[model samples]
Target: MAALSIGIAGAGLLGRLLAWRLAREGHRISVFDPALGSEPTFDGQQAAGYTAAGMLSPLAERDNSSAEVAALGWRSIALWRDVVAALQARPHFAAIGSLLLAHRGDASAAQRVLARLAAEASGTPRAQALSAAQLGALEPALQGAAHAWLLPGEGQIDCVATMQALHDEARGVRWHWQRTVAQVRPGELVFDGAPSQRFDLVFDVRGAGGRPALPVRGVRGELVWLQAPGHGLTRPVRLLHPRHRVYLVPRPGDVLLLGASEIESEDRSPVSLKSAVELMSAAHSVLPALAEARILRLDVNLRPALPDNEPRTEVAPGLVRINGLFRHGWLLAPALLEDALQACALTQPAEPLVAA
Candidate 1:
């Protein structure tokens, strides 16, 4: 395959991942994102990954996602590791599996989640039903969780570190940080107030920034970080609730990534008090120790999603537009990238996101 000059317009998770992948293929690559910066501020926030719990859970998402999505996630576990290994950068990856917790009153919620995951098994992984004793054995820190389901093989990643590692590894790629791309066309990219450039291929991955051109709607998501070392668990936990679902991703340095609230609107404001209180209360219910955790900060961002809440890819003569990842950015990125590569005839033949 011949290397081509490729210009990527975005600095989000997908943008950064694709940049290094293309660069490693020996292509001339340049990337731009408005929120690109050296550090994610003292508040520990970035435009994309900082607020995400980064759960790479395929089976756990079986309820609302298409079979294609579940398959894509099933593939991303290996693809993510391969992508990271190809760059030789260390990112936090915990494949110890994930937990689905439901209180005594929510036995139906836990059963429903388990049943849905079981039915999606068209070669996808399965989640094991767990008794209270089993759950306690796995995560000793969790309390007040009577019934649970252990989604085997699910995991998480530190999105911030992955991006940083990619940045350090992709030394040859040109980075145009803090630049907003106004227009993108095949072989052409027009910056907001800079000279336009031509390339062999142009990638429009601006997330919500390219909404004018791409068919993407912004879905706001918010997460709360806490300084809770002793409250940390071994893996990600998804607690089922009647109103909203809560996920807690434990990170190094005794920090807990508690998220998030999903809303239909595109509002970027701080979390509403109702949602914040609900989230905290839910967390406390799952792990009583969380009551003592110090409040760190509230993080909010909108995920680009289509009406179907599924990711998509569009390819033209010299342009490729990928978006609508929504909340599955981490779980589906590799498969979507494979689609992008297949579209460009840059990848060897492989199975579809889900075999027919």
Candidate 2:
């Protein structure tokens, strides 16, 4: 097969991943983003990737996602392991699994989660019910939780570090940074206040920026990063609640990411006081150490979602659009990239998988 020239619009997580994948296949790739080239201070204009909890929890996500997504997410974990191994420098990541806990009052919620996990339509979404003793043995720091479940083989990634690794490893691709893409057409992109450039294929993974063109909505998520110093949890922990499903995913150097509040609004404002209080109160309730953790930063981002909250890949003549990753960016990216490659005729069946 001939190497095709692919034009990618959007330099967020999807764009960077797609860029590196194609470039490794010896294809000519050009990435155009409005924030990359000109930003000196790393102001995240197209940066939803930077704010995610980076949880690669396929089983944990089955309740809120379609079976197809669950399947894709399960596959992505292996792909990510390979991709990270091939990175210029590996990012801070862990596959320690996760603990899904619920207080005695929320035991019903925990049971509902268990029921949903049993009913998951795809993937080997398995979990073991945990007694308080087992839970304490798993996470000795946790307390006051009567019911819990241990999800094995799950993991978390520091997306901020992974994005940088992807960017650094994406060698030999043309970058058009700080250049706004007005319209993505078949075989070409219409730039804002500039001449249109043509390519053999176009990839639109612009997240919420692809807005009215794609039927995508922005769901607001706020995450709080804490400097835990000497008191950080060993692995990611999920606390089940009536209104919020909170996760505290740890990064390297004693940093704990406490998140997140899922609201149905696209308001791009700072974290609300009400949300901070609610998240803090819930996390502190589960992990008492968080009460004394140093406040690092509060971040708010709008995740792109379709009506079903599943990511979509559209194939057309000389064009492919991938979006609606909705809180599953890391979980679903590798499969989505493969979909894009197949859509663009870059690879076919019987091709050997790319190994690190």
Candidate 3:
């Protein structure tokens, strides 16, 4: 295949992922993102430290996502390993699966739905249903949980590390951090105060204003951190509820992350007092021991989400719009980027989207 020059906007997970993949395929790539360095903050707090950490779980997401979610997720899991491996510093990958626990009243219904969904996804890797006893045994730290669902093959990646790796791994790609692209024209990307260069393809991946048609509204998610007390569980745990779903992920430095709430509004920065109280109470309900855990930090940000919860990839001749990753940017990035690369004729795989 012939080499191509590609311009990618929005240096977040998807934009960076595509840039690295295309660069690996020998395409001349240029990346632009306003949030990369300028720290020109948005969404109330600084956007520099935010991450899309959760991976894609097909069975777990059956109620909220399309079949495309799993297919892309499986492909991403395989793709991320290679992308991460190529980096000078490999990012941490936890393939220990996700633990989803529902409250007692909602346990049976959610489990039945999850089990049926898992059975339907039999050919693909599946989420295993767990009895209360099994759930408690697997994660003894968890209490007051009536039922659980485990997606054995699903996992998570540190989004910050992955982004860093993407930039570091791009050998020839030009990255213009802190540059806000203000205009889009054929064969050229124009940053507000920078010279514009023509290219063969332009990708509009700007997070905030990238795609207007996508039912993507910003969802505010806040996470609270506490120093871990050496729990033996080696994976991420998500406690389910009707009003708020909480996830506690184990990180290095004896830190455990607790996130809850998907605040649906244009205002992305406000960390509601109501939400915070609800989160702490929910975490305490799951594990009373958490009451003693030392609070480390509180973080809040908006995750891009689509109403249908499906990623949209549109290729219109010279330009492509890739946005609406929703919450699975890390989980679906590998496959989605692979698809983009193939569409651009950068990779000559057997199932190439464009003829070489």
Output the number of the TM-score-best candidate: 2
- Model 1: residue 95 alpha-carbon error in angstroms: 1.2
* Candidate 3 regions with alpha-carbon error over 4 angstroms: 36-49, 108-116, 193-195, 211-216, 350-356
Q: Alpha-carbon error at 233 in model 2, in Å?
A: 1.6
Tell me each candidate's TM-score: 0.93, 0.94, 0.87
Candidate no. 2 TM-score: 0.94
| Candidate 1 local lDDT, 1-356, one digit each (tens) | 88899999887777787887777668999887776574465232245555678989888777778888988888888888766656555688878899988888988777777777888855655777787788888998898877777888898988878877877777598888788889998899997678999999999988766678877887888788888868759889998888776999998778888888888987887778888888889999988888789988887888888878888899999999998888888999887888788888866665322213
| Lowest lDDT block of 10, candidate 1 | 347-356
Best-to-worst ranking by lDDT: 2, 1, 3
User: Once model 2 is optimally superposed onto the true structure by TM-score, how far is the C-alpha of residue 312 displaced, in angstroms?
Assistant: 1.1
**Maximum-lDDT candidate:** 2
**Per-model CA lDDT versus the true structure:** 0.81, 0.83, 0.69
Which is superior by lDDT, 2 or 3? Answer: 2
Candidate 2 lowest-lDDT run of ten: 36-45
lDDT of 3 at 99: 81
